[model samples]
Target: MTGVLTDGPASTRSPARFVAFGGAAAVLLTVVMVGSLDLHRLTTTAVGLRRTISEYALGPYRWVFDTAVVLLAAGSLAILAVLVRKGITRWASGGSLAFIAWSVGLTLVVVFPKHDWSVGPSMSGSIHRVASLVAFISLPIAALLLARPWLRDAVWGAHARRTFRFGLLSALSFTPILYAVLVNVLVGTSWWRVLPLGYIERLLVLVEVVSVLVVAVWAIAAAQPSYRRSNTSR
Candidate 1:
């Protein structure tokens, strides 16, 4: 994998740019995912993000959602590969693992629906929950881990700082809402029906999307000899 992704020893910035652009495209498609759903029927405030995605996966147009996730996962893997090739140091390895874990979680979302968990504690549902947790946790961790190295690298310092801020904000954004959701879950309370989890989760998703784009920009900047030269020269 390393050899294939890092095969080019040329000083050109093509690879990083490609991965960066792909990441941007993936984020855009993810935004479109909301429009693809029947928002009126599925009221955002009540439904969980996982439940919505899972239900969509079972719907007649499941392929649309599934394909988007697959593309996003592919883009993530490509970004990780480039990160490894650059050998940015400081949690890069951990970040790579986090990337893979996130992709796995994405795949599991389609494979295991919400029923296995929401209907009752079934094996499939358990796996779905596990996948969702891993996906949610790993993405932020990867951003954090990668951020330090980017911050330390002189050429990428400013971009790294920005990426770190975006990542930290994204990670922290959902804490209060997540607390509310967990409290509801633990108490088996009916308040969750009105808690607006879907809306909160969507907001978190937006943060995450921004975080990804910010990181992609950092990666592109880091891969170059220097930002100005990469653009001005070959």
Candidate 2:
């Protein structure tokens, strides 16, 4: 197995890469699992769960999710920053940095505190809808920016195409999930009961899981010196 960051003679994968990858994986997994729980049901359930595990679990969960979001944004930004400094795909790096900043700000200001189980006109219900859209959309944007060269010229061109396709799908999947979360928040209806809501939720979950995993693998591959050298040469 190759190092996570080193490509040719003098490259080494930073521990930060591993941390970022792990955080990304957690973010993806947590979104799927928690997202799958019927929001309306979970909200209603939080009423009771709060008395039991909600309070105990709330702080840790919030911290973990919040930290993961920040880490992901930061990680992506760091990669883009390096690329920009190195004069590789400066435009893409700039755009990725902007998106990462936006994502972090949105999460902190809009989504973090809302994760609380508090009742009465709280935004927690809609937070997932908003955050998921931002998270999924920003990721592919960064991925495209970071992986543009590899995507464009690799002999296995299908890899880049798949990455783009998955990114688009992940971004698009948020629509239904967002709608489902919104409907639950606004109307008190169960998203699962709807004809395709359950299926949509599952599909979104699958897409997120697979997308994150693919990106993690891609990140590792990209960090490889040989991979970078080949793409740059192409």
Candidate 3:
């Protein structure tokens, strides 16, 4: 199979590839820098703050995460768009872009604010709850779309199968990490909350960080036209 799938000669780059790689790289770097911050101390302090002020202060943090999420979604969409332009997988690529757009809206309006630890029964809270639920349900939908032959084959063939496989795995792994962050760290409503939610959150975050790095590397490698053409030919 390896011999049957030898890559082609190198060629010039596409602007879309550059956009995808640069965006992914920027996201990875931002995540690394943010991960280095003393979130433990920050979260602890925010948790202790009188809920109102904590809510206000968390806005900036939420914005930062929202920005990162937007960049990642854009980068991924750019990759898909490039593939589609090359006649790789029109439907799958389009669906993926739609999913990203939906997810971005949900992340900003719902999931992002939930990290506040201060928002209560307000307009924002309602929007957050609705959006979060939508986001959660959309995850499986996005996963299915991603796994579809058109999208998966295009990406996997163009970028190294191993790289594409890892990207899918990274997306899947987000399920567990998201669960931990939401049920354990964010809510803290159950006896399970008595357990060390902090540790779980951190561990999951580490996984997410690693996943983004893998994606960034894949994006960079996939930018080469030779890589794209080889995979598409197969």
Which is the winner by TM-score between candidate 1 and candidate 2?
A: 1
- Residue 49 C-alpha lDDT in model 2: 21
Residue 198 in model 1: shift from native, Å?
A: 1.2
Model 3 misplacement above 4 A: 1-11, 38-63, 91-103, 110-112, 115-119, 133-144, 147-222, 227-234
Per-residue lDDT tens digits of candidate 3, residues 122-205?
Answer: 566656655644543443444344434433453454334443454455456546545644675566755224444445434443
Tens digit of per-residue lDDT, candidate 1, span 94-149: 76677678778877876776553335667777787678777777778777766665
Clashes of 2: 6
- Measured on C-alpha atoms, candidate 2 has an lDDT of 0.49
Q: Which residue pairs in candidate 1 collide?
A: none
Worst 10 residues of 2 by lDDT: 48-57
TM-score of every prediction relative to native: 0.75, 0.52, 0.57
**Models ranked on TM-score:** 1, 3, 2
- Cα shift from native, residue 233, model 2 (Å): 7.6
Model 2 C-alpha lDDT per residue in residues 1-234, reported as the tens digit of each score: 111223247545655445545645554655554443435346655442222111222554545445544554454444444334333345445445644644564455334343444554356645644555565556656555445555655343454556667767766876775676678889988754433544564565467546545555554444434433323432
- Most lDDT-accurate candidate: 1
The CA lDDT at 73 in model 1 is 72
